[model samples]
Target: MNLIDTVRIALRALLKNKMRAALTILGVVIGIAAVTTIVSIGQGASRLVQGEFQTLGTNMILVLPGNTKRGGVRQGGAPTLTSVDADLIGQQCPEVLASSAVVWTQGQVIYGNENWNPKEMLGVGPDFLTVRNWQLEAGGFFCSSDIESNAKVCVIGHTLIPKLFQTTNPIGQLIRINNVPFRVIGILEKKGANMVGDDQDNVVLMPHTTVRKRINGSPLDNVHAIMVSARSTGKMNVATKQINSLMLERHEISPGDEPDFTVQDTTEIAEALGMITGTLTLMLSAIAGISLLVGGVGIMNIMLVSVTERTREIGIRMAIGARGKDILRQFLIESVVLSCIGGVIGLVLGTGASVGATVLINMYKPGTQWPIVVSIPAAIVAIAFAAAVGVFFGYYPARRASRLDPIDALRYE
Candidate 1:
């Protein structure tokens, strides 16, 4: 038969037994859906991780407190970063553009009758916003004079403002932190949650001096950590090394002895996190791929049954000058049609599922936008795999149909 004629015959055959055809294609639908959904989730995760890191900026170094040990060995002491170290680094390191020593205290914040107990309460220098690249959405960060003079001013995060103040213009309003009052100066532009689920939005920033004098009751000498930013990407390594060496010298650490503080590059940390997330994506995709193979097997089983049921029909067609290749083509096309139909259905379902999953994930994590990305290559591969299953599974059935004797088929039924 001609290709078009063969397709028409195949469609009639499948239409004649609608439930059986649907059952045969069920495997393909499931396999395609699983594969497509997995790829979408993987791509979404990779994009989310990359975007999250991008917001933190590039070529930035964070000097954090405490030391890491190995094998039950005492490795180091807590980081005792002070304003003096921050000033020294800013003066000595040419690669460093801005440096800030950060201190913090958590307290109950009250605006009128509303109150909040946010976890992330920070005391930062005037240069903190500059070094960390934080932008103001509503007002401004405190000035150098504010930190030096211990001004009772604060900048609230997007999440903090609504929870405590309730749609009020937070600027110029006084809020009490642990019963100590501070005027609202600015509202920070919203930054979404990081991988650790820490509330990047629910924070309150105050001057380092105010934290020391009013909140902490400690001398204005020590800090929790130092944040530093390089002028360009090229200067990152040099800046880190310079800061490390400077700390070692200041702390009087000798060669082969570990330093007290840890200087971490945000870019490297981001790359490492990306690698981990990427690996997880691949693993999930692989697991989903197994379903496709199962679907292929189902196609084979159904094709064999079809050959058995239509044995007499096959004999008559062969008797009427039909070649074995023509018979083969007819059966193969039937399987392929089933697969293609299933693939289309699966594509719709997979896309919808991925979008729904992304929406739900975003709802739980505000400002973290994860988009459901359709993988074109994955779709193409799925279609190709369906065609391949048709060829592989339809072959034996087609051959069995073609090999039947014409006289015997006429006599049997």
Candidate 2:
């Protein structure tokens, strides 16, 4: 028989056992659907992480306190970094554009009769918001005079707006932090959350001088961290090294002594986090791949049963002039056709499921925007995998049918 004739006959046989054929195809459908859904979710998760990082800042480098060992035990926490260190790096490092020193604190903030406690009250320089890539939603950011005068002016995040001011306009309003009054100057634009689920919009900002001398009761020179903006993404490494060297010199650490502070390149932190998420996505895809393997086995089991049931039909076809290879070709075509039908249905189902998942996540989390995308390459590969499964499983049964004894099969009633 010609290839077309063989395929037609194979299709007819499958149509004759409609219920069995549908069952056989179900396995492939389930497997392919699982794979595509997994791949889509993994890709979406990667985009979400990247977006979260870029939301709060761009090209930011952090200077943090380093740990020191006492005898065999780790004791001292990060040495206090100061505004002086930030200024030196800004002046000496050609790769740096701007820098800000942060003094971190927390206390109850009261606006009129309303009292709300914020998680962080940041003491920062005027350049901190610029370095962080944060924009104002209302009013203007404090200027250089605000820092120099040790101004008790502040910027509040969006999430804290409702809690502190309610329906009233917060701009120009006076609020008290631990009874230390501050005039509301600007409202920070909304930034949802970080990877660790911490609220990025739940803090407040003030000059480092005000925070140190007034609220925290610490010396005006004390700071917890320094945020530096690199001239460009490409210059981040150079800026970090220069900052590190300048810090060592200012702290008077000798060549063999451990540094008092640590300089962290934000670009490196972002790259490392990306790698971790990518690995997690890969592992999830692999786990979903197990379903595809199981589906292939189902095809093999059903094919074996088909070979046994069609023994007499095969014998009659041979007696009537059909070649063994033609019988093999017919059965193989039937298996492949079933897999193809299943794969098409699976592609649609998987795409819909992925979209639904994205919507649900955004709806529940609120403010967390997630992407919904179907990978065309992954769908194409899944279909190709289904075809491969058909061939590998159908071959054994096809061979078995071709080897059957004509007289024995014909006499089997």
Candidate 3:
């Protein structure tokens, strides 16, 4: 028989037992769906992490305090790094283009009887936005004069606009941070969430001196951390080493002793996280691959059963001058069709699941935007794997059907 006629006959046979055929394809469908969903989630997570790090700009360096070992253990309470340290780093380190010292705290912000707590209330310099590559969505950044004069002026993040300002112009409007009044000078563009799950947009920025002296009862000298941007990517390491050496000298730390502060490149931290995420993606894919293998086993079991059940039909075809190879081809086609159809159904289900998952995650994580990404190559590979499974599993059964003796098959009840 021609290939088309053979396929038609094979399909008609499967149609006779629709329930059996469906049950047989169920495993394949489930396996493929799981793979596609996992791959999509992995890709989405990678993109989210990369975007978050990229926002901090290139050739960035971060310095934090209180890592000094006192009695063989680091002091743990609060950062000991101060604003003077940041200033000195900028002056001494030629590779550093700009530097910003930040003192972080949190307090309820109130406007017109409405109150909401920002995710972050940070004390920073005019260079803070420059180091972080952040831009004002409206108005302008608080100027250097604001920091120098200890002005009661602040910039608010995009998330705060809807909550506190709400359709009104926020610039020049007074908002109370812990009941301490400050004028909003600018609105920051949306930054979304970072890899640590912190909401970057839900923040308020003020001059470090103002926040230290006014909002919190702290000495004007203390700062929690410092952010520095290098002039070139190649100079990041150079800047970090110089900053480390300068900090050591400024702090009077001995060689081979733990320094009171730490200097690190932001890109290095990002690269580390990228490696971790890549490993996680690979692990997830491997788990999904296992499911695909289990589905192949199901195909083999069903094909074996089918060959036995159709023995009589096989016998009649053989008696009517059909060759062994023809019998084998017919059974193999049936298996492939069933598996391919199941794979298609799985692709639809997996894509839908990925979208739904992204939506669900975004709902729980306000200010976070996770994209739904389905890889076309991955989809093609999945489908191809499903078809290959069908062939591998159906071969033994198809060969059995082809080899049956016509007389014995006919004589059997």
Instruction: Compare candidates 2 and 3 on TM-score and give the better one.
Output: 2
Backbone clashes per model, in order? 0, 1, 0
- CA RMSD of each candidate after superposition: 4.0, 3.2, 4.0
273, model 1: CA deviation in Å? Answer: 4.2
Point out where model 3 deviates above 4 Å: 1-9, 52-60, 69-74, 77-80, 87-97, 105-119, 158-168, 173-183, 192-202, 213-220, 229-254, 264-294, 312-323, 364-368, 405-413
Q: On residues 1-413, what C-alpha lDDT tens digit does candidate 2 reach at each position?
A: 89999988988988988998888888888878888888888878777777776764668899998876678577677455778888888889989999998888989989877888777789988888779899899998777788888899999998778997789999999999988999998999887766556788888999888899988887648689888999989998888888888888888888988887888886787678778877887787778767766777777788888888888999999999988898888888887888888888887888899999989987787666777878999999988988888888788888888888899989866
**Alpha-carbon TM-score of each model against the true structure:** 0.81, 0.86, 0.79
Q: If candidate 3 were superposed on the true structure by all CA atoms, what would the RMSD be?
A: 4.0
- lDDT tens per residue, model 1, 208-231: 878978899886488888888888
Better of 1 and 3 by TM-score: 1
TM-score of candidate 2 against the unseen true structure: 0.86
Error of 2 at 225 (Å): 0.7
What does the lDDT come to for candidate 3?
0.86
Estimate every model's Cα lDDT from 0 to 1.
Answer: 0.82, 0.84, 0.86
Candidates 1 and 2: which is better by lDDT?
2
What TM-score number comes out for model 1?
A: 0.81
lDDT: worst 10-residue window of model 2: 72-81
